[model samples]
Structures are given as C-alpha cells and as structure tokens.
Target: MEFGGMLSLDFYLHQNPDGGALLDWSRRLRIAAGAARGLEYLHKVASPPVIHGCVKPSNILVDVKFCARLCDYGLHFLASQERQGLAGYVDEEYWLNKSGASKECDVFGLGVVLLELLSGRRSDYYQENVINIVQWALPLIKGLKFSELFDTRLAIPFNIEPLVRLARVALACVGNSRPNRPCIAQVATILTNLEMDLY
Candidate 1:
C-alpha cells in the first residue's frame, strides 16, 4: 500500500527536490500513459463506472519506477446525468447547464493536467490573460509546435512523436463538441499504442 513517496501527487510533481529527475520527458510520457490506463480501468474495466470529477497533477502520484498511480479519489463520485458543478476540475460544457457530470468531464480536467505537467506550471496560475493552462496550450498544440509549450527545464532529445500524440488526445478530451470526445477506454488504447511504439 505504501508507494514510497511524499504526501500527494501535486507535492511529488512540484515540491519534491527529486522531482526534476523523475519529471523528464520519458517519465512524463509514461505517467501520462498510466493515467490513461487508470481512466480506462475506471470507465471500462470497472462495473458502474467511476468519475474522478477532479484530475490534476497533484492528484497523481509517482512510484519508485516513476509509474503513476492516480490518487485522491476522495473527490471521485459516481457518474450521473443530473449532478453538475465542480471547481477548476469540471468540464467547460457542464458549467453552463444543470445536467450531470460524466467521464468526459474527468477527461477534460485530465487534459488540463497533462498540459500543466508538460508546461511546468499550475493550472490556475497564468502568466498573461490565459486564465487556464489548456487555453494557452491549445494554439501551440494545434500548430504542432512542441517546443513552444514543452518544459524548457528538461532537455527533450527524443522524437516528439509521443508528445504530439498525447497532445492530440488532450485536444480530443477537451473538444468543444462534448459528444465528439472519445471515451476513456478509447483514449487509453491510443496511449497504449503510443507507449508500445516508443519501445
């Protein structure tokens, strides 16, 4: 049960001194893959499907091998078609309506978290007018300019293929058309394929 780390995923990602060593590009890809897998398990593998409701870097813990295990299920709730409203974590579409939350909401929040990990900044902390992390990264992602948004602290020497794929996945998750967003299982499968290709 002991994952051999610090208090929370946010702490591990941001506050830990050893974080730099584990937060490199390769490890980031792996952690992203693990997160996709976790979401896959929740949405497809589990009965009755669980919606995390909040998916942020701080909620994701890194293990000894740098594999990620999603934590802070404390905010997780059963998927519903009637409930609505969660802070920074809720999907944009759900914000305007009283309709319930779903797995897609988690997917949107995960996209924001992914961008935060890549950019090395807090989701809410903005440099300019870009209030949210995803909003700022969207243009760079769509234009395929990896360097524009990637963490400059780390030297990324590998072919940026995986990062591009992950970006696409994130975009799909935060799609303006909510119904067009892929399910968690679909997203996980795509990530798994990307991971396999990296080997």
Candidate 2:
C-alpha cells in the first residue's frame, strides 16, 4: 500500500524524462483510467456513495509501475449534502451550498486534473482565461485541431483519434450542467477503452 516516495501527479509529469513518448502517454492513460475506476467504485459499488470533494493532481498518487491510486479520502463527503471544502476544485453550481458534495462535483474536478495531465500545465496557469481547461480545450477539440490544444511537449501523432476520445471524456466530466456530466462508471468505461486502444 506504500509507495517508496510520495509521488504526486506533478512530480510524475516533471520528473519523467520521456514525458512525450508513446510509452509515457500509455502510462498516463493507465493512471487516469485507474483513477476513473476508483471514482466509479466509490460512486456505484460502495454501499453508500462517497463524494471525493477534492480531486486534483496532488491527491492522485503514482506507484512504482506508474499506476494511479487515489488518496485523501478524509475529505470525502456524502453525495446528498452540500460541499464545505476546497473552492477551486468544487463545481461552481455547488460552491456555496452547504448541502454536501456530490458525484458530479468530483467529476468536474477530475476533468480539470485530466486536462492538466494532457496539457502539462497547472490548472491555475489558465485562471486568467476566464474559462477552465475544459472550456479552453473544447473548441479546439470540436474543430479537430488537437495540435492547438494538446501539450506542446508531447509529440502525439496526427491521428488524433485517441486524443479526441480523451477530450470528449474531459468535456463530459466538466459539463456546466451537473446532469450533462457523465457518471464515474461511464467515464471509467470510456477511459478503459482508450487505454486498450493505446496498447
């Protein structure tokens, strides 16, 4: 259960020399897919759904094999109540409500994290842009211009099929309306399919 060192998403992204290689892309997909599955289990498989109020890169841990394990469940709250913690990661719709965190909020945060992984940039870096990564990336994705949206450091092929799929998932996760967001299980399924295609 213990990784030798504390490996946050930032650490993994920066420390790895081959950040843009295909192998690295596969690794990222695995990590992200694992995180999606973890969230899926929490929402659908658990007896009582647990809403991970905070879903950021710092909270996602990487193991020796580069597998992802979500941590810091201490901030998890019941889906039925209003959220009371972490402003930046929380969905705007649920920000002021004290009713407690919900699955949709977590999904929004997950979308932000996924954008960071793909962009090799921090979420805060794009704060001045008014819209978050999802908003920034959607237009490019819809226009089939991934080269304009993808991480410049990464040499993802021009094929763009996988990148499109990933972008779609991210868009779904960060939908402005909670109901428009895909459930964790659906996100997991999409990511799992993308991971298999990577192999």
Candidate 3:
C-alpha cells in the first residue's frame, strides 16, 4: 500500500494549503468511518487481536481520496515505554491499572481524534488554554450545544443529524468508563451507517 501523496490526519486538522478548511462535513464523516473500520479490523479481524497503543491524528494517514489508513498499530510495548506524546491520547485507566495499553485506550484516543476532527482545535490545547480535547468537548456535547462543537472553518450543514450522531459516538468513546465504552466494532457500525446516509 503506497500513500504517495498521503498526508497525516493532523494536516487536515489545521489550516489547509489554500488557507481554508479542506475537510467539509462529508469528508470528515468519511474519514471517521474509514478510520473506525480500520481500527475495528485490527481489534477483531486481526488474529490474536491487536492493540493500536496510540491512536492519534498523526498516526492516521489520509490519502488524496480522504481514505483513512491506521498506522503504527500494535506498538504499545514501545509506546508505553516512551510515554512522551501519549499524554492526552491514552485513557486514565492505562496509568492507574498499569496493565499496559488495551482496546479501551485506543477507543479513547479515537474519541480525541474525532473531537479534533469536529472542532479545529488540537488535542494539546483548546484555543489558547491548555485543556485536553475531551475536557473541552464533553461539556458542549453534554449540553447539546452541537453548533458550538462544529469546526468554524466548515459551514454548519442543514441536516445535522449525522454530525450529532458522530458526536454521540465520540462522547461514548471518551466520556464513558472503560467498561462502558463501546468497542471499535460497534463504533465502526454506527459510523458506517452514518457515512452511508451521507449519500
């Protein structure tokens, strides 16, 4: 598989080459759905079940067609040792349990990525404040302030049902406790349906 002109999802999270948002609502949904499917495959279809260790924007590469490809999967052992950039991506249970990375951790990371995809804000900081994406988005998502959660770069779509559903999925992945978090398979299913609805 060659990502000749592929760019990391992080590239789209910020300003595009044209100084405008490259990811509109539809493209964002497609990327999210594709990324979910990739992770679901790794966790369920892959023999022995692989843990992504770190699931962040930079690890998800988007091709010219906006196809998401999950990279650096099953690197928990090395990533857990470094623990440098894994700050906001990994779940709290990972540090508390000391059992190493798990599927739940990956879900939490994807939730963060989804939040970043929704809002143009980075995981490291929101606006000028040093708040994690989950911390910043949870309240807005809970309050049903869907408008505020959308990235300002993209005009809010008239039919917001899909975006709302995606937000709920992100909330489930990050806001819920590890035991309560939906597995990647379930997330992929929801996102797949949402993507299909876009047509």
Task: Point to the candidate with the largest lDDT.
Answer: 3
Better lDDT candidate (2, 3)? 3
TM-score (C-alpha, index-matched) for candidate 3: 0.94
**What local distance difference test score does each model get?**
0.71, 0.74, 0.87
Please list the residue runs of candidate 2 whose C-alpha ends up more than 4 Å from where it truly belongs after superposition. 14-23, 74-85, 125-131
User: What are the runs in model 1 whose C-alpha is more than 4 Å off?
Assistant: 1-3, 74-86, 125-130
All candidates' TM-scores?
A: 0.83, 0.83, 0.94
Candidate 3, superposed: residue stretches over 4 Å from native:
15-20, 80-83, 125-129
lDDT of 1 at 60: 78
Cα deviation at 163, candidate 2, in Å, is 1.4
Please write out the lDDT profile of model 2 over residues 1-199, one tens digit for every residue: 6868647775666556654453366777888898898888878887777777788877888887878888885365533343333545667777555654688888988887777777775565334557656667767767878678777776776566876788778877775678788888888999999988977
- Local accuracy of candidate 3 as per-residue lDDT tens digits, 20-107: 2678888889999999999999999999999998899889999999889999889788754545778788888888877768999999
How much does candidate 2 score in TM-score?
0.83
Task: Point out the higher-scoring one by TM-score: 1 or 3.
Answer: 3
lDDT measured at residue 120 in model 2 versus the true structure, 0 to 100: 70
Better of 2 and 3 by TM-score: 3
Model 1 C-alpha lDDT per residue in residues 1-199, reported as the tens digit of each score? 4767534556656777776566777777787888889877777767777767677777777787777788765354454544332455567676575654568777887777677667776666424564766677888888888898887777765687787888788778775557777877788788778767777
